[model samples]
Target: MRPAPAVVAMGVAGCGKSAVGEALAAVLGAAFVEGDRLHPPENVARMARGEPLTDALREGWLDAIGQRIAVSVASGQGVVAACSALKRSYRERLRGFCKDIVFLYLEIDPATAKQRVGSRPGHFMPASLVDSQFATLEAPAADERALTLDATRPVGDIVASAVSLLGEANS
Candidate 1:
């Protein structure tokens, strides 16, 4: 059977979760699920309007992503997903679906995050909400099966590190 690891590239809006997740998926020969694309239209509109999402608003989204992960894992195909899993509870919710799920936390400073978010065009999330994202972030605890990478690093380096970590984790 093929490896069936499930990994989430998690962090705040501008933390390169999408880019790193895509690259990591390519390296792992896995499917890449864009979490933002899975968000409800109402959530997108609210974020576009500079409103932060409440926990209640995010529950369904998290469940949707978890479902995707669960399906992929059950098929014995590895999967990598990008999500702004800024809270421990959010990560835990995902873990509820797949016990072996791993998280790749892209750590970034607020200034860089704000600058990056501001530069992205056509994104629903606004730079104005970057502060809210930071406030919501609860870094993974030491016990969690997670890898922390510097968001400032090049995508290639970050992906390489993740590949190494995943190798060790699966071995």
Candidate 2:
């Protein structure tokens, strides 16, 4: 029998990773992990002050999240996760822990990302850092276990579409 699906909803801040990840988890009947909350308090404080985190700063956090995903899947507790996963190396690191991992990249232009982040009430990521987020992002390539969707879609629509693809893959 096939193991359950483990998904990561990935993008820059304000691209709806949390909302969509939660919705997809609901649809898939999987556990939801909020990657933003998994960030260390110092990382949160630094970003809240409008600082962009360096790769070195994000390594441990990424590893921790990857471990959670692996444990969940190993236990047959499938999950949907939200993580920025901005760079290719970061995605690859997560993949190293779970080769069957699937990434759903929510692609957004810088202007929209900045606009959304600016309006967000209490998020640690400031609009000022959206540019750096874009600079770091590497959209999933064709060969990867991933899908890219427009980030501007309605939450329901995005979740429904993702369910179709994931359900198909699982079948």
Candidate 3:
């Protein structure tokens, strides 16, 4: 068996992070955590109003997610967390807390992402914010250990590819 990874499904909103993360967790038999649930009410409100969150507003939320990763690592459990870790700094924060973490970035085009976000209902993140997400996204090209998957692919393919990446990394 391959070693378990502390996995993070990262991308802009509407890239299916939560869905893919959940499926990946089930396949890996690891805990699935939706990073959005850790967001403070203020952050949610800011996004709801189509306002992009400043780094200051995001610090607490990032810390909360990092702490979750730390706890999961300390317990010797693999965790799959879905977060919009849009910047290198944010990813660094997560890595600081979990040493065995592997990031899977869902790469989706702006049009497709906008469509997905627009179609979804009851989500606090407005479609208008997606542009900001893309603008803020600093992809991890330097990090060769990170897996970049096409979010345009079928969900099954995405999950399978992620599993394969995790398998290879842990082997």
Candidate 4:
């Protein structure tokens, strides 16, 4: 049997990772995992206070997300995860769980990201961290199996494009 499919919808804060990931998962009939929910309380608290998370603080969170991906792969079920996998190393850590995992990069300008994040309410991540997110980001290189999309596009359009592309590859 074929291995389960996995897709990580990744970007800086305010890039609509959660919204896009959830919609893509629904279209593909896969489970959606909000990476933020896996963050340790301290991490969430720090972010809520408008502080950026250090790499040390994020290590455990990344491991937790990787563990969830491992479980889904073991269960032979697909999963779509929304994470600000801002660095190549972070994506590499997730790839340790499933080498074939696809990454959907929501490419957006800092202004747009800040605007989107600022408009959201009741969210832990603040607009103050937008610059930090972009600062840490390392876009996937040409060799990586990543899809880059303009995050300013509509959610439905993004998901539809993802479904069409991933369907051909995953099928």
Candidate 5:
């Protein structure tokens, strides 16, 4: 049997990357990695204080995710990771680790994102940073192996779409 394909659930903070990623992973019978948990302590503190992370600050976090992707790919076990790959460069960096990785972009508007972020009690990212996330985001280009979906939809619906996409990609 062919190995399951890796997927990255990517978007701004409140775009439901984690929810979709977890659901997709469960359906795919693949491992799920919450990218937020991999952030360094200092980065978490900065985000909690509403400070946006510079590219330099995010390097280590990206590296950690990349390492995990490499491991999963090498083992032939798929992984679904929730990450805010805001910049094109960041996504490119991750692609270096796994050539077949597919990006699932959860498209969301700023108002909804801010509302969601504000309602989430303990997440390190603050609602105020929603603007910065928008500022930083470079939606996946046409050539990239990516699937874009509406984040405001129900999680089950989103996961269903992702599963369909994965099935197509894997075939």
Candidate 6:
């Protein structure tokens, strides 16, 4: 049997990780997992207040997401997860969980991200924290397992690009 594919959609807030991840999962015939749902209420509240989450605050959340990936891997299920794995260390934690893991970095400019965040209603992530996200983000270039997609493109295009990248990698 072919090994299961585990794709992680990663980026800062408002980079369309959730949207792209869901679409990519559908395209790839994989199960979709939204990482934000795994965040503890305290972490959510902190981000909602425009405060950056400290490593201590993010540790449990990262572990939870990593464990979920491990579960999917063990089940032989293809999984696509939406998460802001902003740091290399965080990505490494996920790498420890699944051997077939690939990261899809949704690259976007700050202005576009801020506009999207501001226009979106009823979202906990405030536009004011966009700068902080940029500051915290460590782009995942140089990682051969990573694919950088321009998130400013249309959703259809983004999904197509991700699908193509995944297919190429898995082939």
Highest lDDT: which candidate? 1
lDDT of 2 by residue, 1-171 (tens): 788788999999889999999999988889998998889999999998989999999999999889889988999988898999988899999988788989999998889889999999977788999998988888888888888889999989999989888877667
Task: State TM-scores per candidate.
Answer: 0.97, 0.96, 0.95, 0.96, 0.97, 0.96
Locate the minimum summed-lDDT window of 10 residues in model 2.
Answer: 162-171
Q: Please list the residue runs of candidate 2 whose C-alpha ends up more than 4 Å from where it truly belongs after superposition.
A: none
Pairwise TM-score winner, candidates 3 and 5: 5
Model 5: per-residue lDDT, tens digit, 71-131? 9878988899999988889998898888788999999999999999999987888899999
Q: Candidate 6, residue 34: CA error in Å?
A: 0.5
Q: Whose lDDT is higher: candidate 1's or candidate 4's?
A: 1
Cα lDDT tens digits for candidate 6, 1-171: 877899999999899999999998898788898999999999889989989898788889988988998898789888999989999888988888886789999999999999999998998889999999899899996954899999999888999988887889888
Which residue pairs come into collision in candidate 5?
none
Error of model 2, residue 106, in angstroms: 0.6
| Model 1 C-alpha lDDT per residue in residues 1-171, reported as the tens digit of each score | 544989999999899999999999998889999999999999999999999999999999999999999999998889999998899999999999998989999999999999999999999999999999999999999999999999999999999999998888878
Model 3 TM-score, all chains together: 0.95
Candidate models: Cα lDDT each? 0.94, 0.90, 0.88, 0.90, 0.92, 0.90
Higher-scoring candidate on lDDT, 3 or 5: 5
Superposed model 1: Cα runs more than 4 Å off = 1-3
Cα error of candidate 5 at position 107, Å: 0.3
lDDT of 3: 0.88
Task: Give the higher-TM-score candidate: 1 or 2.
Answer: 1
The better-scoring model by lDDT among 1 and 3 is 1
Model 2 Cα displacement at 159 (Å)?
A: 0.4
Q: How close is candidate 1 to the true structure, as a TM-score?
A: 0.97
